[model samples]
Target chain A: MTDCKLCSLEEYLKLIEHEEITYAQPHKPAIPGHVLMIPKQHVAIIEQIPDEEFGKMMVQANKVSMALFESLQAQGTNIIIQNGISAGQKDPHVCVHVIPRREEDGLNFLWVPKTLNEEEMSTIELRIKENLTVQLKPKEVEPPKPEKVTDDYLLKQLHRIP
Target chain B: MADMSPEQVEELKEKLKNMSPEELREFQKKQCIFCHIVAGRAQAKKVYEDEHCIGILDINPANPGHVLLLPKEHYAIMPQIPDKEIMHLGITAKKLSHALLRALHADGTNIFIANGVVAGQKAQHFMIHIIPRKEHDEVGIDIPEKLLSKQQLQQVKQHILPSIAKSLGARLQEQPVAVEQVSPKEQSAVPAPRHEPREVVIEDTPRKAQPKAPKKEHPKKDQTKDEDVTLDDIADLLGGS
Candidate 1:
């Protein structure tokens, strides 16, 4: 089993720079300067990560983007994450791709659409509408009773060296 | 020791019980403390509160003094919001913006609404981001320029007009009894009939003053002018490409 990478930011940085992790691109050599912000834990996808960790990841991603701007002189950047195979995820690791973009670079990533028949289109539309309606409908929920974890204890646990 | 009275707790519980499932989900996602605060389970730095909505300081702000305006009854996007709850969220955002300007001494502000996941909406709950903007702080928000053709612009205008009209119709329905009772004929008689949408009419009138006149002298001027206009604006005018 792959060990949890959460404790060592330095080790995580090294792995990102090593280029073997095909799922995430390293900041150096590829796009001149690009960074991949990822959870050190082996979380398969965003849905699997806890809410607090997810929020912290977002904050880190933002910080990395800011660093890219300052260091690389990046004019623009794109924050992308491929969740499932259908969304083009080749790896199971949950990571956010931070790609720095420049003006008139001809880096086109547009997707070409295949035409669908009228019946097929109608079927897809109907299915989506039905799903949305169902999702909006109310459901019973068990009362939310949060576990008592003090801030100090949680902080120490999160920051502990592996 | 209790911060809120028993009656206040009961009032909050009643509101929570009446909330739709979608609203509850939104509250769970966006207003993290609302559920905890309501249950007397968490303490939060509350900025503003009313029966329908609440404003609070964002724990992790894009900039200092960033505030979030959330509806007590949750809806994801502005379009999904009910007519009655319209002014409540918008007014709260406006008030917070003013407060940020006065208290934080911000240069400008951006009222951002990321509607869905595609739009970078992290929280499923409908929340308005009252981000206080500074002149030179690199926040990493980039707006792509899209070029559009004349035909696309016309198509978009045609498609959106009906939806805009429907929204206006819904708004009119919520007017006071006497105002609602007035027929289209009476309304028209009261105000001059305008072809443009009421909202558009107010904003568009200023543009008519600066009529485009073809300049014959400098050929370089035309090239520079084209460069000045953003590709996004062109794309918007032409419809999405």
Candidate 2:
């Protein structure tokens, strides 16, 4: 964990720093204005992140996207997450990539559509629907606790009266 | 229809130019088939639907089980979306990705958003493309890496850093992580604001907006029932220009 690059993002050019998320430039960017929104905690993948934290990350990502448009005058932006190794996640620590794109930026996020037979499509759909359950635990808020006034103060006052 | 007459094309362009931004947005929404799908005017194989979002099967998918999750509200680009909706989209994408991983027995998933035409946005309405992936799936999302020189990096930083700082104003109370490591004394120069203990955060309102109503989940048995034949071409045609 000590060696994780994202745990210590001090080397990178920092943009916006929140309590949970840190937006910074990649050491080797896909594009010039490309920045990464990384969680401060060492979460390996998206699944490991709490729902509220994930939502917070997205909020920050949108902010950075806006900044890309306003500050850099970027024509477009791609907010991409490469989840696992096969999806091109290099670091164990999950980071959301916000790349500022333009016409023919030489970036290839485009993929050719594969032809799936009816049976394959149906099976995939059914499987996903059956397993797709979004159980978002509502955020719990702690109520304010009133400060306690102890009777020990009265005894201390009596001693001081002498 | 692919080849329009020069005069006809010129006429359409002139008509478009005269419309105000609001009118243009309405025009874009009218032309956007995804908007039509959200409105229930167009047929779609919907996998999931909430008050704020709709997840539909992408007919022209990079991989099978590819889902295009969209906001119910029409927005041309990501920058136009409000923070609340953006948060909702993010959480929804995460849920969809979780489902894709578990159901498809896939190695991984990609949550991709194309914000503009240059970013490969085919539909004017912003949607997050959640694609389930496997090893050697031939889905080439491999972005070309460019290493910027020190001077070039500084220039890019100078351009964007201040605006982000200003936007985050009072929210940011600490120095950059890098700055803190190098000069701890300098951190003290910037007075820290008194951190207030946050009160009870009301649960987001949209969920309550449909509290008693059952979630609208349409799991279609017949994948091809009442399919709009022209639906497939709309994406192609809109992105053609």
Q: Considering every candidate listed, which one attains the maximal DockQ?
A: 2
- Give me the displacement of residue B153 in model 2, in angstroms: 1.6
Give per-model CA RMSD.
Answer: 25.6, 18.9
lDDT of 2 by residue, A93-133 (tens): 89999887766657768999888777777777777777774
The digit string of per-residue lDDT tens for model 2 on B31-135 reads 889999999999987888899999988888998899999999898887788888988888999999999998888899989988888888888788999999899
Q: Considering summed lDDT, which 10 consecutive residues are worst modelled in model 1 chain B? A: B218-227
Interface Cα root-mean-square deviation for all models: 21.8, 6.3
Docking class of 1: incorrect
**Highest-scoring model, lDDT:** 2
lDDT of 2 at A58: 80
Residue pair clashes in candidate 2: none
Q: TM-score, chain B only, every model?
A: 0.54, 0.66
**Per-residue lDDT of candidate 1, residues B9-121 (tens digit):** 89878988999987767655555545554333765445656787766555556665556677766555444565456545555555555555545556655555454443455
- The parts of candidate 2 lying over 4 Å away from their true place are A133-162, B1-3, B20-22, B170-241
A1-162: candidate 1 lDDT, tens digit per residue? 244343233222221221112112232212333345556566665556654455444334444444444333345545544444433433566666654445543333322223445454344334433433454357979899999977797789778958
